[model samples]
Target chain A: MSIKQEELEEIYAFAVQLGKDAGAILLERAQERFDGSKQAEQGHIEKVNAVDLVTQTDEDVEAFIKSKITKQYPSHKFIGEETYSRGVSRDYLIDDEPTWCIDPLDGTVNYMHLFPMFCVSIGFIVNGKPVIGVIHAPFLNQLFSSCSGKGAWLNESQKMPLTRNPTPPLPPNAPSGCVFSCEWGKDRRDQPDSNLHRKVESFFNMASEIGGREGKGGMVHGVRSLGSATLDLAYVAMGAFDIWWEGGCWEWDVAAGIAILKEAGGLITTANPPADPATAAIEEVKLGSRLYLAIRPAGPSANETGRQSQERTVREVWRRVRHLDYSRPGV
Target chain B: MSIKQEELEEIYAFAVQLGKDAGAILLERAQERFDGSKQAEQGHIEKVNAVDLVTQTDEDVEAFIKSKITKQYPSHKFIGEETYSRGVSRDYLIDDEPTWCIDPLDGTVNYMHLFPMFCVSIGFIVNGKPVIGVIHAPFLNQLFSSCSGKGAWLNESQKMPLTRNPTPPLPPNAPSGCVFSCEWGKDRRDQPDSNLHRKVESFFNMASEIGGREGKGGMVHGVRSLGSATLDLAYVAMGAFDIWWEGGCWEWDVAAGIAILKEAGGLITTANPPADPATAAIEEVKLGSRLYLAIRPAGPSANETGRQSQERTVREVWRRVRHLDYSRPGV
Candidate 1:
């Protein structure tokens, strides 16, 4: 039986509240140990061991969120950050049953360092497709939420499609005009010649009018590495960033973001676009396959010309940074 | 005669409030034009023209801050972002007298995009020395301030030196373990093998476990490019970021940050270490020479070993990405 639209809406509301609650607990824990105001006398022993407390906080928040959600939706399946970190395979769990994909704390590294760029990310998937998502950033006091067909919102007032009139594709002689976002995840397996090293090179190329290592210039204005995949995707959905290239994050990191991005009319594909578009399936998007490219949606009311401009911008980006792709070979 | 300590304190308070007031006006102007919420129907012509409004906010806030500060300290020299952007050399302005260096809006790109990483930065210099600095981030509702000899602060409550217990030096053969921050300024003079291209290559190398183009690996835990220099410095002073390497920004971008960094015990050296540190004068910091390296302060109560550890961390970082220096060739 197809789940009714109203039921998805109810689930969306429930997950949003659950995200906010989980965010609160993490926020309190972070604030208590956030800085070194009083540690002026402590030694390296204290510095080296700080991550332990932070690890516990992560586990606590995940446990709290899991208990609350499982209690409410007793039959629902749950995949959380800590659980996945403990060696669970996140790719094969989705099915016809309702699965709550959650990143109880999406930017753990940033949190341990006291940088305020983390959030609680939650997405509800039904029949292997994301139908709802909610992300709460307590430090910034911003909530981004969406349900399929209901539209996405930021802090309940600002709707998505942050820009309908994004700058048209760059003049061929000129550089692309868009803010880009990417990251260097914890899994830095290969060294000087690895795909990551190349990806980081591409990021620098995009930010510069200057050519990269091989002397090819990307010229895409600037770049941002905010250290949060979920927030990076959310910002693209809100149009703060024109595009976000992601890798290495699990299903929990991108699931909730996919729901919000879909509701906002954004598009996602493999990090490297296919030579033949017919082979790509939007429905078969792999949340943990380790390579993704996301582009901002055209404004909801954008004319056909505006939509074409948006696509042209994406095409230019793909051409310039396609060599940065590392996902396919490994897969 | 040397200015009295109490008088310096008063000036610090005055500048802090002025920074916040200017920040508030800019914040309000930004919110009014932040996104394309109701603007989805607008065309590229309109989107391209939006920068015109953003430019107005930048100049308007600068004028507002300059006018207010000039009225209060009519005899003091003043340098603002807009005036400097109009081709005034920021150097040679610091004679023996008092002069206010201000960036009415730092991170204009972020402001234009409605990203919350912008701020107002103001620093008071006396006898060619930064005596007082105040950086106010209105969106974050944070004020970081400092006067000579007095400690820096966040919101005037939490003291600076965000972490008294910094990570010890990298053990031999270990990666440079720290969170790093850098920026991509908009000056693209030469393409295909420019200094920036080399600099970006260095950044990628720092993030990798494998060595850089020159066979050096920084092995930093991660990197952040939040797009705001003033806030970047403030965060460094607050200990959130372990090191910040900046080039191409004006004096207005870093003077306030310099004062706070000094008060917090943080240190600033050129992006490239001087060939002879013995000949360098802390007094001749060259605020607008356009390259800087900021490191969090060692603890006030730490032993000699702690100080040595801090120095070692800096040494490792310097070895990793020091090719990013764009100042000397221009200096």
Candidate 2:
């Protein structure tokens, strides 16, 4: 479904407001924790599973966002990580109504460890497609927002205007160097057909190929794993980092980021076959596709060179990595 | 060989001023290159041999510092990275006089790459030992300083009292985690003994044990190769990371950081056999003794546990790494 420009603007502003509200709550909670862990409390939030974590802060933040959105726009649907985990249907495309997808706290692991890399992400999905996104990182003091057509922006200042050095109608080139973000997901004890190992090896091989043996031949400049998908995508939008790839993250992790990236002249696709946005709905994007690639705009003169370099590096990487049978249920 | 405290203070203040001044200059130069390759006219910085890196900036900064100090007190000695590299004998003996040791730019690689991790390091060595240190990272707006008796500090605030926590230090108990930093250096040719290859393999083995075996206990939290020694040393002081082992870096690369880390109750020794400060003179610290290990603070309660864990891990790492012959001059 095509979203009108005015509708996109409205959604973008709503997403930004929701994100800032959630971000403020997160900041307040983070400040309270600065005095250090206040006694080991055991509750649903603290003791979710044997090892996995879901702090009270996460629940409160997520619930607060849901309530705010519902109160402001009662007809709009909402899906959040915390709510979804508690038996909410994963089917995000149940209706054509605009649904808000949120990850109150992305980089939960970093938050659990007090690593200071977490952020609040809010995405507005219209008819099963994300068209407006906002990501706020209180600690880093950065707010990234994007509407489908109005273009992506950082802190409401710099508009990431698409430029082809000489002016466009020119095919976009691959980035000079790409930065991919990888994370060791929850289930370290469970190895599904060496999926984890293949992912790790693929990262090393791909990085080496792109960066060259010592950063020479590879089309990519370098790679950085900052432990947060939201921040990685934001960095890609800001031109601080060129590309970000990942697997095993939930929709909540990338929904907001995907929208922001798209608006910033960045491309997101399944690492296997390139993603066809026309066919794939936002919520239908699967993690077990086991591959995700985000590429930034290349210069006019070197666009083709950059694309060919990236394609060659990715293919080389795929050839070396053993295919995992993630086709299994619950992998 | 014992120097007067008044003289040391003068040197410390001098170094701090110089570092801040140089860092500001570096930041300005870096900002100028943000839009395009500002250095294209002069060719790549790396194209010049390592020794030639004592550029006009370095020389100018050093001269500015030296002139100020000499004008005030002609008896005081100055030992800067550029000056020492030219002809000054590598000697750290106190000899009853105060000496200022400075690295105008630490993490030159990061500076060249525009990574924003490099810094200016300055230390006042008395009687062959560092008594005062200051490290300034202009871009990050962080200044780390420490006087032997006054305790370490960040930006003249948040004093880092040299107290070891009784609990087991975070490193060893830190589930198989390590971060290593290495430079590609000047030698890029594919040789069996290539330092880059050895460093890379060491990092890989530590992070993911040899042969990709899981239960073998070689896996680490992750590895990071941030190209800055002074910043790496400061990180060790901050407890953000565990161990930072590196080779092929020189005295200028670590001198000031070593002082700061020691003041913060951390440890720095030759990566091989762990040099004892009691016997090793300041001048005895050689570039050839490039193998270095910077370990975070471990308290009495956690000392044994941390030592055992680190010892085992390092030994296991040693088994996988090829022993380098530092006996070869100027490795």
Residues A49-134 of candidate 1 have per-residue lDDT tens digits of: 22212367667788998898889889889988777656634345666788998888888767766677889999988887888999
Best by TM-score: 1
TM-score of chain A of 2: 0.79
Best by DockQ: 1
- Global lDDT for candidate 1? 0.70
Proportion of the native interface contacts kept in model 2: 0.00
DockQ of each: 0.41, 0.16
In the range B223-273, model 2's lDDT, one tens digit per residue, is 444456677777666544456777666656676777777777676655553
